[model samples]
Target chain A: MSKYLLNKFLYTVDRDPELVERYREDPRGTVAWWEAERANQLLNCHTGEASTWLAFDDPEREALVAHDYVKLFELGAHPFLTLTLFIAAFERDHAEPLGFQKEYALRLQHFSLPYPDIAT
Target chain B: MAELAAVIASTHHPFYYRASTARGEDRPPFADEWVRKITAFRETLTRANPDVLVMVGSDHFHQLWLDNMPQFLIGKAPVYDANWYNEEREFGLPRMVLKGQEDLSGYLLREGLDAGFDLAFSNELRIDHSITCPIITLRPEADLPIVPVYTNIFAPPLPQPKRFVQLGRTIRELIESWPSDQRVAVIGTGHLSLELGGPRQFGPHGPDPEFDQRAVEWIANGDLEGCLSEVTLDSLHAPGNATHGFMDFMLMMGVAGEGAKADYVDTLDLFHTMEAYFTWYPSGGPGLSEERACEPRSEGKGESA
Candidate 1:
C-alpha cells in the first residue's frame, strides 16, 4: 500500500500549492497533517520495514522528496502520472488524439469523475 | 596534459536488466545480441585503460528533486557511494564505494560556472541508473575513478542541446589544461528513442526503432550538424517525453569534437537504443582541429583502432 499512499500523497501535493508550501516549511508536520487526514491509509501502507513515508529534517531533505514528486507527477517521469501532465502543464500533443490527453480523458471516464475540460 | 582517450555513448535504460535476464517469452531477438555487443564494447574500454572515466549523464529525479533542482551538477567525492534509490533497486547494483576524482570535479565546477553554466557541486550526490546501468555493463570492474557531470533532462527546462554541446567543449578544455598526465575517457550514458512511463511508451507505440536507426547512423557517420538540426527539442520530446537521453549524445559529440572517428556502432532494434564508440587521437585523423573542436563539437568521432 506504499504505492497507494505514495500515489495519494503525490496526487494531493500535485494539486495543492498550500500543502506544498506547508511541506516546504515543515516536512515532518506536513506528514503529520497528512497522517491526521489519512492515518488509516498510511498505516495500511506501512509494513514492518523502513518507512517510505516522507521524513526529512532539513530543507535539503524536503527538496529531495519534492524533486521526486516533481519528476514523477509534475514532470511526466512516471506513466500514469504522465497523463496528469495534460491538465497540469497544458502541453498539447503534436498529432491527433493526443496520447496523454486521450488516456487522461478515459481515466476520468473510468473513475466517473467530471472531465476537466483541459485546454491543451 | 590529460589526454582524451575515448568518448563512448550507450543506452542506460533500467529495463536493460529485464532484457538481460529474460528466460523464455520476454527475450527479444536483440537481447542476446545486445549483451554480446556491449561485452565487446567493454573489451574495447578495457584496452583503452583510461585512468579516469568522466561520465556525462542526466538525473532521474532520484537524486535531485524539484524544490532545489540544479540545471547542472558535478560530483566532488573521492569515492562515490552507489546507493540505489527507488526504481534502481531492480538493478541490484552493489552499495559499494567507487573511486571519484575530486580534482576534475572542482575544475569542472569552477570553469563550468565561469562559462555561464549554473553548476551545482555535491560531494554526496547519489547516481541513478542512467549512469550505473552503463557502468555495470561496460565498466563492470567499477575500479576506475570517475567524475560525473549531470544535467536535468528528466524534467522541463532541460538544458538546451547547444548548451550541452558547450558543456562538452568545456570538459574538453579542462581535460586539455590539466597538468596531470591522466589518460581520460568520457562515457556519455543514455541514447536514442525511448518512451517510458507514458501510455504510448509500450504496445504499438512503445519505441520508435525507425527514429533510433536513423539517429544512430547519423552519429556513427559523424554527422554532428545533421544530428543537431534534426534531433530538435521537440523531436526528442516526442513519443512520451522519452528521448531526452539524446542530450547525452549531443554532449558526447561536443566532447569528442569533429575530428574523432566512430570506431564501433550498434543499434538495438528492440529497445530503440543505439550505442557508439568514438576515439580522438593526439595525432591527425578526421576529427576537428583543436580550435574547431572547441566550437560546439559532437561526441561521436575519434581515432579508429
Candidate 2:
C-alpha cells in the first residue's frame, strides 16, 4: 500500500530466538544496523497480521519469503533487491550471514531456462 | 493461448544510479521518483492475477561468475520476496512474497529440448537483481509466483542471440503444456541501450536516444534476434551492458511467443550506457483477461529466418 524506493524494503536479522538474543548481546557486530532509522520504522510498521520478509531461492532454485529472516536483515540495515536466485551479501553467503537464517529460505516452483556456461 | 506478459533482463554496469554508475565511484544511494514509478507498475502487474512468471535475465555474482555460477537455473518456491540493494550496507533489503512456484521443472525440460537449449537445471539457487528487478517491477510485494531462467550475460561463453530466442519458445511450450489453467507473465529484464559505467565513459548521463530508440524498436518488433544477428558482441557492448546480455531478451521473446504490445511506458534517460522501457505482450487485446488458455504459440522453427 505504501511506496518503497524500488522494491518492498524491509530489514532483518537472525530469526532463531537464541541467535537474536546473541545479536542483542554483541554490540559491535551489529551496532550500525541497530541504529539505522528505517530498521526502527519497519519494526513499528509490522502489526503481526501482515509483514514481508526477505525473498530468496533455495539451494535448488526454490523461492522463499521467510519474513522472520527478513526481519533479521531489516534489523541489521541490509536491504537488497534480487530475483529468482537466493539473495547474498557482499560480506557473507545467504546461509551463514545473519546468524544462519536457513529456515527462511523459500523454494518456489519454476522451470529453468537454458542459455550457457551458467554453472550453479 | 500462452502469451508473453513482460520481459525482464539483467545487466552489469550500473546505469540507473549515477552515484553508483562508475566503478568504485560510490555516491550516496538513491530511491528517487523514478524508483517510485517502477514500484507502482509492480502493483499493476499483481492486480492482473497471473500464474507463473517466466524470468529471463543475467547473473552477476548471485548465480555464476568466473569463480562460481550456473549457466542455466530455475526457481521453485511457494513464496519469496524481491529485494532492493542498500549500497550503504552492501546487503539486501528483504521484501516478502505471498505465494508462488508450481513445480514446472518437467515442462521446462520438455520445451527446452524441443527449443534446442542446453539447460543447467537446479533446485537450489539465489537469484540476483538481473532476475529480480523485473519481477519486482511487475509484482513489487512479491505476491506473485514465478518460474525463473538464468542467462549468462555476465560471464563468458554466453548463448548467442538466436539461441536465446529458442529458449523463449520453450517457455511457451512449458506454459501451454501445463494444465492448471493459470494465467502467466513473462518478464525480460535488461536495458534498451546501456553503456555501462556510463557516467565514466560518456559522462554522467544516459545513452544517446538514437541508439536506445533503435534497440527499443527491435524489442517491440520482436526482432531482437535479428538485431543481435546484425551486430557482433563487441559492438553490442559499446552501447553498454544492456547489449552485453541482450541476446537473452531474444530467448524471452521466444517464450512470450511473438508480439510485443505497442505500449512502452516511461522511456527515461536514466543514465549513460543505460535506458529503461516497460512494455508487454498483450495476452489477448484490450478487455481480455491475462490468462493464456489457448494453444502454445506456433514455433518460429528457428530463432530467426
Candidate 3:
C-alpha cells in the first residue's frame, strides 16, 4: 500500500549496515524508530506480518533480517532491490566507474528526482 | 491468435548513466553518442506500438536461484508489484504495478508445456534490470502490458542452444494459436560479451569484439543455424561471464523465426561491456516462408529444392 515507505525502509537498510545491526539489537526499538520516522509505514509489504517482526526476539530478528544483509536481500537468487547490484558494481574494477549507478541516475532524471547522495 | 509485430534484441547493460565518461573531442567519456542511440531506439519502439511486449531476459540470481531455478519461467500475474525486484529506487521505474497478460500467460503455460517446454509459472514473480532497464529506457506508454520470461542463462547448466531455439519456436507457435488480435512484440535483453567482476575486471574482460561482430553478422543475415550452432557456451563465456547475454539473443532469433532480417544493428563499446542493439523483421509476414526456405526444402522427402 505505502510503497514509498517500503522503498525507504529497504533503501535505508540496504544503504547502511549499521542500521541493520541496530535493527537486530533492538527489533522493537528499531522498528519503532522506522515507524516514528514513517520508514516502515508499509512494513507489512516488506515483511509478511509486521507484528511477527515486532514480537521477534533480538536473535530471532537478527536471524530473520540481519544475518546476511547482502545475501538476504534476495528471495532466492534475484535481489529484492536493484541497489544491491548497484552496490556490488563497485566490487569490480573497470576503467569506468559506477556503470550501473550512472545509468540508474539517468533513469531517475526521467522522474524529475535528484540523483542519490549515497556514496558507493 | 496474436500477430507478432516486431522483435528486438539489446545489450541490457546499465550504460544509461555513464555519459560523462565519453572520451575524445566528445569529452572524456562518450556520453552524447549513447544518449542519441538510446533516444532513437526508444522512439523506434514507440513508433512500433505493440499492444503487448513479451520480455525475454536472463535472471540476475534475484528471483530464480541455482537451488531451484528452472530453465525457463513465465510470470502469470495480471498485475505485479515490481518493487519487490528493484533495489535502485532512483531509476524512476514505476515499481508499484506492472501490467501483465493473465490469459495470454495461461495459454503460454499450457501450450508451452504441450510444445515440450516445462515452463515454470509464478504469480508472485519479481524481475530485475534485465526487464526493467529496457522498459524504462524505452518509455512505453503506461497501457502496454508485458509478459516476463525468465531464462537461466547466467548460471551453469544453461539450456543447450537447440533447446533455447526450441523454446522460442514454441512461443511463436503459442502466440500464433492465440485468437487475440493483440499486436505482440518480443524484446530480448542481454549483451554479447560482458564479464562482471571476473578476471578481466581491471581491463577488457567479458565482452569480445570478435564475438560481437560475428554475432551481428549471423543475426543480420538471419542465419539461424549459424547463430544456434556457431555460438556455444564456451564462445559466449570466453570473453567473460557477461556473454551469457547471447542466450536472450538466441530466444529472440527463435521467435523472430529463421527468416527474420536485421533491420538495424548498433554496438556500444562501453567499459567492461560490448553492448549491441538489434531490431529485426520477418522478411515478409512472420517469416514463415523464410523459415521454409531454410529447411532442406525437402528434408523429409529426400531432395533439395
On DockQ, the leading prediction is 1
* Ranking 1 against 2 by TM-score, winner: 1
Candidate rank order under TM-score: 1, 3, 2
Question: Model 1, residue B31: displacement in angstroms?
Answer: 4.0
For model 1 the local lDDT of residue B187 reads 87
lDDT of 1 by residue, B88-150 (tens): 333334565678999888887887788787788888877767777778777878888899888
Native A-B contact fraction in model 3: 0.00
Writing each residue's lDDT as its tens digit, candidate 3 over B1-305 gives: 57777788887754363343445764534577677677766754665667898888876655564336688999999875553323443332445457898888888999888877888989877777788767755753446788999888765567787777778878887887888999787888876765443333324333466776777666655678888767776666575555666777888878877856665566666665665666654423444344434422111212221
Span of 10 residues, lowest total lDDT, candidate 1 chain A? A111-120
DockQ of each: 0.10, 0.02, 0.05
Docking model 3 quality class? incorrect
Would you give the TM-score of chain B in model 1?
0.84
lDDT of 1: 0.60
> What TM-score does chain B of candidate 2 reach?
0.73
- For model 1, fnat equals 0.10
